[model samples]
Target: MSHSTAFASQADLAEKKTSFTQLSANAWAYTAEGDPNSGVIVGDDSVMVIDATATPVMAAALVRRIREVTDLPIRHVVLTHYHAVRVLGAAGFVPEGAVNVIASRATRDLIVERGAEDMASEIGRFPRLFQAQESIPGLTWPTLVFEKELTLHLGSLEVRLLHLGAGHTSGDSIAWIPSQGIVFSGDLVEFNAGVYTGDAHLAAWPDTLDRLAALQPQQLVPGRGPALRTPADSLSAIAYTRDWVQTLLQCARDGVAAGHTLQQVYADTRRVMDPVFGQVFIYEHCIPFDVSRAYDEARGIANPRIWTDVRDREMWAAIQS
Candidate 1:
């Protein structure tokens, strides 16, 4: 099979303007035109970074932003999930005083299971995102792991890291700050961007989303896109994400029930998804993987298969065929 569209992101070499928007006194969002975002929480004495960027060099940009506001050491790095784009930059924060790398127990498990493959896979897909790819040391390991929920005090500021449920990945976590009614939702929530459910638990995504909505955060820093500043916008982001997942799963289910081929399901899913989400950032890059996973889950595959550079190409070729 021939290559198709070059991953849709290989050509996305244009730089995106980065924004460091302050959501609250303690919370700031590091967003770039729909790229994965990182969250910053400043306490009285230390700082915490949520979702490190794709590479240490990329993470240095976040550190620059953090330093502009405070000289406090970055004491913690939280992994909302195990995606390489989000975790590989943990080491970048080490110099900034980040000692403890924290993640949910399940996220740590995923790193052990497929981290190396994912690291190579993601770097290939989005070359521009990994600015200085050579700077990456290896798969990021979480020094501190928690089960369902873990709460920490960054010098009196309370931050709750909760493993809400399976959605974007089996080990997705969200950082909630009750004091400011702010939450940092990793890839579990996206606004004005493609919701990549390439390794998602589609059937359980909605319910997990429900749990996030129950938090009623006043402001939310999603995994991508701009920060949601209003409670209304936060709800909209959750609703939009749910709609994306539900619509794709429904299309996959319909196609599978009709005994259609993967290519056929891809066409069917696009016919429905494109009209609404086509214009978003990375929509093209995400569609193939998202549709493939949706098809798998619809066919009763409970766990998402590990993605390798080879498997990614094979899957892409199959759908293109």
Candidate 2:
């Protein structure tokens, strides 16, 4: 099938080349051409990982990369959100002596509400990312959950995880290292890649981006791009994501105001978004879902609806029709 006509990501088969880039003394990023990125923080005593890959088998690759830098035990695995692609790989770190999986209370709530459905939906949507699908035990549950913010001491280095606001998802959280002026933004910021808003807060996303920018991070690890080393590059990533969100929402609003159907709205959104984001990785895969969610939000859907495998096919058909 042509990439444009195929179901989400099913046509994508090529493996991405991964890079392990150090952003600070304690901060590192594992990015893969435009695939989901993971963050590694090597503390004085222990280590912390943000956003596990899609499956336990996939996460082993990340573990190997971490071992190249430090033998420190991975004590903590932090979930930036409850997406299956991000959290289902927690079990992979268990063999490395990772004891605790951390996430915000809102994240845990999301897992309770729709984690299973999301897992099934995502596995069906992006087959390649799942790698060894049989290796995933089940939904990843956080052993430690907190509200608003939580502070952890990996020996002497302090890592702060804060749920600043809802953007990517209502449960979105970020890891901030105050001493090093570094931040790990999970799927909240995308640079030179498609911003997936399939389960996002379209209207609140820009404001959440503002709160993330307020941290004034000297270095940043975005969800889907290369690590930003300079403050200027960090801010530019934020602006890049903000512009995408705002532009997408505006297109949805304009289409809805003109009484366009979902298909019509999708076409209208593509006309505007494609010119700029068309060449980005996963652009073809993400735009359909992004347009669907934006259209729903513009028509007064406050909360994102659950997406199951059945729903995924139905939506794909509706847009394609």
Candidate 3:
């Protein structure tokens, strides 16, 4: 098979430019051109990092960016979810200081359950994102786990971590800086990028998004795109993510209602969503995974199936063949 015909993101090895922009006086965003983003919060004494990069090597770049502005130790690291691409970089933060890795209890459970399988799957799928796979020592386990919400203070800065509901994953959480009116929405909101719903809770995602929007953030750092600097852009990102999820789920629902096979459902979904979201980042790469999850949800699959590397290839072949 040609490289293009292979599994999603398999051959995408080109480098992307990284942007580290300050969102507020204390909050910053390290965004690549649609790759996973990390949010930085500089408090009065120390620093907190949200969403570590894919590997320790990749995360070193984020640390360098953080050092460009502040020399305070990175005392806290927060995992918004259990995806390897987002959390495996916790190792990188250790060198800076005694990092207190934090996550929702559900996320920690997921990491313990499927973190290995996910690491292999993600590395195989997105080579460019994981710059140095060997640098990843092992699964990232959070030292600090919370149930619904946790509040912390980095000196005078107040950071509220809340698990609104399930969207990207069962443990999806967002870092809210209430005083700054800034929110670091993990994968719950993607701006101008295709949503990756492979491990998503499609049915509950919208309501989770509703709760996220209710916070009325003035600035928002999305998981995969540039940081939104204004309240208008922040709200628009939420709307965009909501529409994408709704559209994909609706297509899956329609296919299931008409008694279509998975392949047929994928085809129908691509036919409609491609024209609209085809130009977005990772559009082609995400559709197969997104449709599969959506179809399973439409057919009453409550929990997302574990996506191993073998399963990834099998599913890709089933849909692409």
In the range 61-158, model 1's lDDT, one tens digit per residue, is 89999999999999999999999999998889988764789999999999999999999899888888898889999889999999999999988899
The C-alpha stretches of model 3 lying farther than 4 A from their native spots are 1-4
lDDT for 165 (candidate 2): 86
Model 2 alpha-carbon drift over 4 Å, by segment:
1-3
Q: In candidate 3, what are the lDDT values of residues 28-78, reduced to their tens digit?
A: 999989999999999999999999999999889899999999999999999
How close to the true structure is residue 250 of candidate 2, measured as C-alpha lDDT? 96
TM-score of each: 0.98, 0.98, 0.98
Worst 10 residues of 2 by lDDT: 1-10
- Pairs that clash in candidate 3: none
